[model samples]
Target chain A: MLRSPRAIPYLLLLPSIVVIAAVVLVPVLVSLWSSFTPYNLTRPATLFTFVGWRNYQRLFANADFWWAFGRTLVFVTVALNLELVFGLALALLVNRVTTGRKTIRTIMMFPMMFSPILVGFQFKYVFNDSVGILNNALFSLGLITRPIPWLVNGALANFSILAAEIWMSTSIFAILLLSGLLALPQDPIEAAKVDGCNPVQVFRHITLPFLMPFIYIAMTIRSLDVARAYDMVRIMTNGGPAGRTELLWTLIARVGYQNSQMGMANAMGYVSILTSIAFTFYFYRKLSLSRRYMGGAE
Target chain B: MAEVHLSKVVKRYGALEIVHGIDLDIAHNEFVVLVGPSGCGKSTTLRMIAGLEEISGGTISIGDRVVNSLPPRARNISMVFQNYALYPHMTVRENLGFGLKIARQSPAVIEQRVNEAADILGLSPLMDRLPANLSGGQRQRVAMGRAIVRNPDVFLFDEPLSNLDAKLRGQMRVEIKKLHQRVKTTVVYVTHDQVEAMTLADRIVIMRDGHIEQVGTPIDLFERPVNTFVAGFIGSPPMNQLEAMIGSRPAGPVAVLADGTELPLPPEFAGRVTADQAVIVGFRPENLYPAGHGIPAAGQTLDMDRTVSLSEPLGTETMLFLDFGGREVQAKMLNPRLVAPGERMPFKLDLGHLHVFDRASGKSLRA
Candidate 1:
């Protein structure tokens, strides 16, 4: 009663603002400033001694850093694209299901319910070089006399991690796109059918156009999540086989924790954030374009 | 020649059959309307002809081709839906040409037909706008244009004007009539509104519980409905029907209403009922008016007195609601005179325009 109506809303919102500042804003600003310094975790007093641009300079000249960066770009692109293709197919297939649709949707989300680390461990055992199920099955089936090393080879190791990442995340895309499929007005599809379009034509012309905005939303969210692909790869390979399958997080963790160079790791973190920014920007643009195609305001 | 024909058509869903076996023949360029109440399977019959619903046990032919097993596209029919299902993602030009484009016509042909349809519907100004940008009537015209672009053997409309407001609906009705005249396609339209059925159809098919009770022209249905159902379903503010018994009179036969009031029956229907036979006597509201003030009463006349319960006066006529033998009946009085409540006003009955139905079967006794 003491406060004005306008001021009361601001007063009620103050707690959330304070909480978010403490949890998110402080850490982000501190890390960004630290990325410009020679701060080390072991010697916490070095947090204030700023050696501007030196850490970034050393990172740019480091070949292994660039390799990890390039490898992560490739990994995220291949994994996210495959997830999208499979997720769209799964959504289309599940949309056609009339009976037990709820049960099917719940089952589809089973892989996403597991922790990423658990999925990594599960796939790790399945891909063990000599004793895992994959090589054992290959040996018993007489397809190969020698044991196929799944995790030891560079390409196979990347493929295994990509598979694990896709398995853990594709269902989210399917669920989102399926909900979009459900919300679509059925009249246009019926019109298309009456307008001489076959099933394939209907899917391409009407159904896919309606599903584009949903697809882009899923892509933007998954790009950010897949860029933070640390837990699964850490449990799976730990950047092993002489760093042959090294990604951005593995190198950054090694430099920041194992070598006690937090400032340099934070520098690498800033650069890695650029790739996620690029993907989010690309996907958001595409989402808005599709929305405009549906007659939404630009 | 029949453009679309359904012989012994039926529609069943699992254990329940909605449409019984029925027959309909829509001749070339004939506009036929199926009018009924809800759940009367009028839309089902239309869908069966469009190949949108699977027919259970009969043949539907489009111009001599038995399209029983064919899809809607193969059957070559177009439908205008109730909601005007224009594609929200496409402009009007694209929406109109989509059917032809899918049928693999050349660019010039699709363009020419789309332009022609746009010209017919006067949709050139809105051709570049998406469906969402257009108003409801514009969207409806675009829908009609989409159907016109197809130019198929038959056009099926499933309550296409049910969504419009009354004024827009009236306007669309006139436009649709003109479109039918210009396009000259066989049309099988379905609506529950008797007014729309009467205004638009060359022949009206009145359905009740999935069965066609009668099929006739507007004048035919209005003047000679086959039964009580057809009589009630065909007119607006429907015909007033009173329970009565056939009685012998010294002059002629009479319908003795329940309250001991005797109204003379026409001599043409003298033998349609016997003495003491229970019957339903029906007459249009216009037939009962203030004595000597109606448009000649339109039939053989009998004088009576009834008290007005409520009066609704329009500019041209007053609709007088009165009790006839303890039954609520509406009567029209021309020249707009105020008749107060509880006033026993002299009225006339057009006995020549009366209907007598056997109460047991609800069937008309007239030959």
Candidate 2:
């Protein structure tokens, strides 16, 4: 009874822990347990029936699932790398400007501030084949004669979605890398110049290595966000035409919400979780290695 | 191996001129210390010489080459920053060799130079350690070693020891002196500590508000200060200045204190006295002694019934702060006893070493 005063602080945190477990952890575990049965949302009583990996067996045989899995990997990898390149270029350009720097930084964050859904609607109007501004400009300039099927074709729709995803999230990488650039110590740069290092040598040896950790941090964050590229892809193509742009999310949504196969959808969700985990682990390892390059383990 | 000459060098930051047009000539292998208070533009002057700062007006030359427009690399001068800005990502060995490597020097030559610098700094065991793993003193030594391996014509130090603790500062001061002696590089060092300026400098340039107040050897500035600022700045415990009036008499000159204590001045003050005017009396604490030690009449002495304020007994000598005639006076006593507070002690001041300064200009009348 005397220890109740000291224990009260921890006791107060129990409510928050319980809420989080009920809302987040319990649902994930329940879904994971249901993946072993033939549970359907329409037939709720079937959740207790044991099916023993029948959904996973069906998933292994389903060619559409395999196609969707490969497509998601390619979409994530391309979008992330492209965003990195564009983000690095933007950061470098903005870092060089001495005046109007604050205005430029604020403008750079404008794209990131808009909700991804709004971005999808905006790009959807812009890339629409019949009455879109892009095609109208092209036709008026004598660039094209016919209405191009931008969202209907397989490669073009995938590229259009990838382009929108890159544009929306590239600013996140720039802001992070720019802060890294600002925090770099000026002494090494000065020392290198006095040591007769040319501009390229100074950047390759000193500036780039110092920016590696920040780059990895940005990469980790963006990779997770890109792996779940759903909003724009969901609104524009909706895995349309013939499942040409069907990523994992669209396939999972179709299986669970449209077809009511809750067990198969849960199994797919668990498998997709490994992609985010692998990326996070990879970036974390790189961050630690870069910190070791700077000094002892940070 | 090079002589640096600055002719009317000026540094201005958008009309706020920090380093006024000042001329100086540093002969080959001469160590000059620029001593001043903070914001006195001493470090700015060194940076100008190192080509880190733009010369607002006038020419700076190294070995007869006007380097006013040259960059830091082309100027062939190295600098040690106050923070010891070693590259945190590189090992000690790589940090020392980075410069030579960037310059495209031969691999063997770069290796040999780095080895020599590493040996000079006694960093053989720590060559593999990054800067985050090293101590402050080790990092400072690496900074020096980095500068040394460049073998530039001149070296500049921007108050490099200000970041260290007092004991380490004293130790590094000796090491820097030894390094300078061995290398014989024409070095321009900047510091605000007068003791550092006194101990390390061949010539000390005292600055005030962007103007050169005085430039002379340490002893020259000590024995013959051009003004009250230099007089008060270049000594430990500081030279004591007491407000008084100079009363010229038929015999010689006498400094009359406000408390009506008249003291005869030095014998060489026949021609430098004006009529009745306000003046300041300056003397070192070490010059004052107890009155019973066969005091002379030609040298003036003051007898005061003062309560001891604070007594600092520093093994060989003791510092006593005594309240005298509404002002505080610090005296350095040779064999001081443990005098408690509120005890009246008979203190006397020696007048032979007394200095008189004009109240309006703060210029020493003796100089």
Model 2 spans with C-alpha error above 4 angstroms: A1-18, A38-63, A96-103, A142-148, A292-298, B291-308, B323-326, B341-350
Interface RMSD of each: 3.9, 3.6
Clash count list over all predictions: 0, 0
Query: Mind giving the per-residue lDDT tens digits that candidate 2 earns over A187-281?
Result: 77776766666678778887888899999999898877887777888888888869999998899999999999999999888888887899899
B1-367 per-residue lDDT for model 1 (tens digits): 4488889888999989888888888789999999999999999998888777899987888899999888777877889999888877889899999999999999999999999999999999988998878878888999999999988888889999998999999999999999999998999999999999999999999998888899999999998888999999888779999999999998888999988888888877877789999999999999888886677855578788888889988878889998885599988889977778888889887788889889989998888
What RMSD does model 1 have? 2.5
Per-residue error at B99 for model 2, in Å? 1.4
